[model samples]
Target: MNTQATPSPQFYLTAPAVCPYLPGEMERKVFTHLVGPRAAEMNDLLTQGGFRRSQNIAYRPACESCRACISVRILVNEFKPARTMRRVLAANSDIVGTMHPAQPSTEQFSLFRRYLDDRHQKGGMSDMSALDYAIMVEDTHVNTRIIEYRKRVPGAGIGDQPKGELMAVALSDLMSDGLSMVYSFFNPLLDRRSLGTFMILDHINRTRTLGLPHVYLGYWVKGSEKMHYKTRYQPQEHLTPRGWERYAEDGGV
Candidate 1:
């Protein structure tokens, strides 16, 4: 057998589709398959350049005349939870998130199904089956983990594991410089708990505890109410033509 190195990654642009974030606009994406031995390194590089990962694909928006999807990353060391955020944390103090190896299970799928049904009933992922969910959770070559949030159960001892009702889950990657949140879902019934905001706050705290500089929140689309919440995390940086810069409220994208 002859020894040879693998070829460099080749990217492809997706066909334009109706924009989901903005009305009457089209959206395109530049995507590449993340596989092979260098997948982790390639993922890190692409992500730092403003790409987001979904399962085995790494992609970034390529919409012409539309720069709405801006990459947002929080400065973990400098971040301080706002008053509301503090309240969200206090509200969920009875809950805790434990990091577990990226794995799939029936319990996780049940929560995921419920979240999708309640939050994104018409979204593309609403119909994802359990097997598809497994691929999403386990098909990875990078350093990733699932942060499972649930009502805190009194533990037996220091070495014992937490046993709580599954309420939320976040799939994230630990990068050399930061933590990239791939995806997150929470119990829709817990409206008062504000689990969504609490999850982001927890990620920021986790990033700080890990000595990481940033916590990536994926793409924040301007003009989309769904993405506006990302701006709540103060002192965030947005990737621009001049590279990552301090985000200003006036910044449209």
Candidate 2:
């Protein structure tokens, strides 16, 4: 006894290009635009279907003969911290993250510039200007937010919140199942913070606090060092042809 109308989504495939994660390998993607009045609802469905949103575009791997880009999500309640992850948490104890509207800021762009210059100097987005960065943050049709991380300012009291110069930023999407971290960057000079891992751990904790199920990490390429960290979030599931299947720790079928 249910009557409802579901919106239809149109899909497109991108031309093959060099894979960012795996060198020499080609990458192709099946993508669709997330727009119109039903954008949020459509986003929820697309995410569940293994697509990740970037700005207003939702995309997933569509390689000719490779399936390495597996969509992953941590089962938050079941995630237990490993020894190394505990160390990372301890290392970043002085950093506090504040979630805000997805509106971009000049300070964030400055941090973004430093990060790109230090880390991804030769990557595709290396040439992006402040305007491009702003569009990446603000050009969205679905529910999105930005989490700003900063050093905890020395509070003269115990209960006071931290307020310091911006150290990192993560543009995230609010999905029904969990939050999807669209993109993130930090002050590359602060390499000691292990900010990348710290952010993921923080998001996992945030999801748990929100009583959500998973944190949809975009993709994990098996042999990619940059993506290998994603596998450490145990009790995670991967999107396979069958469905979201639990990842085997032994790296087997």
Candidate 3:
């Protein structure tokens, strides 16, 4: 006859592994499951505290002495798209991103596989199967959506429009502060379009349309060229030990 609620879940840490973003360094993770009735609230707090979501789990870097991975979010209202970003917006003017429920599809997996093979073949998820990709997309316990971008089909570009083949996909979490882009990948062949930059610009516009103030871009490793593209989004705030500090090419005060 013990009608008591179960105790809240506790956090756990994982052993160190070779850091992906940096060489000659190891990385560990302090993580917890985002589950149950309180999961949404839990997720929000952890994300604000600089944790990134993966499936139903939330994790943050627990490196012993390194602080390379700093979380970043665009200052949406303050963000003035640079000349290059303006070109990206124009380049993708024919593409439309439709947000859908967090459900997996074979088409998505196909694009994901091509992306991994072309771009991140040596990364951790190189071996992820379709099932793993599905879990990544559908195992969320909080508000999540998949934004699939494709060419605007002729005659149906507006209003309940059906689309063309998928060009890119972003798995995003709807947070109280902003939209956290969990993961995104596109056809690598579209390098000229700079689909990666286009996606971020698209998200910034989407956030503005939703009246949101920021668009979370996850960690920006200090010395990684692959991560440098994130800094191009001007007027971004970097989560530092002193807290979220706004920065420009001249650095923040």
* Cα TM-score per model: 0.94, 0.93, 0.94
Per-residue lDDT tens digits of candidate 2, residues 103-138?
998999999999999989999999999999999999
- lDDT (CA) per prediction: 0.89, 0.88, 0.87
For candidate 1, write residues 6-107 as lDDT tens digits.
578777899999998899999999988888788889889999999999887899999988998999999889888889999999998878788989998899
lDDT minimum window of 10 residues, candidate 3: 1-10
Q: Which runs of model 1 end up more than 4 angstroms from their true locations?
A: 1-5, 155-159, 250-253
What is the C-alpha local distance difference test score of candidate 2? 0.88
Q: How large an RMSD does model 1 have? A: 2.9
TM-score of predicted model 2?
0.93
* Number of the candidate with higher lDDT, 1 or 2: 1
Q: Give the TM-score of candidate 3.
A: 0.94
Clashing pairs in 1: none
Error of 2 at 227 (Å): 1.4
Distance from true location, Cα of 20 in model 3, Å: 1.0
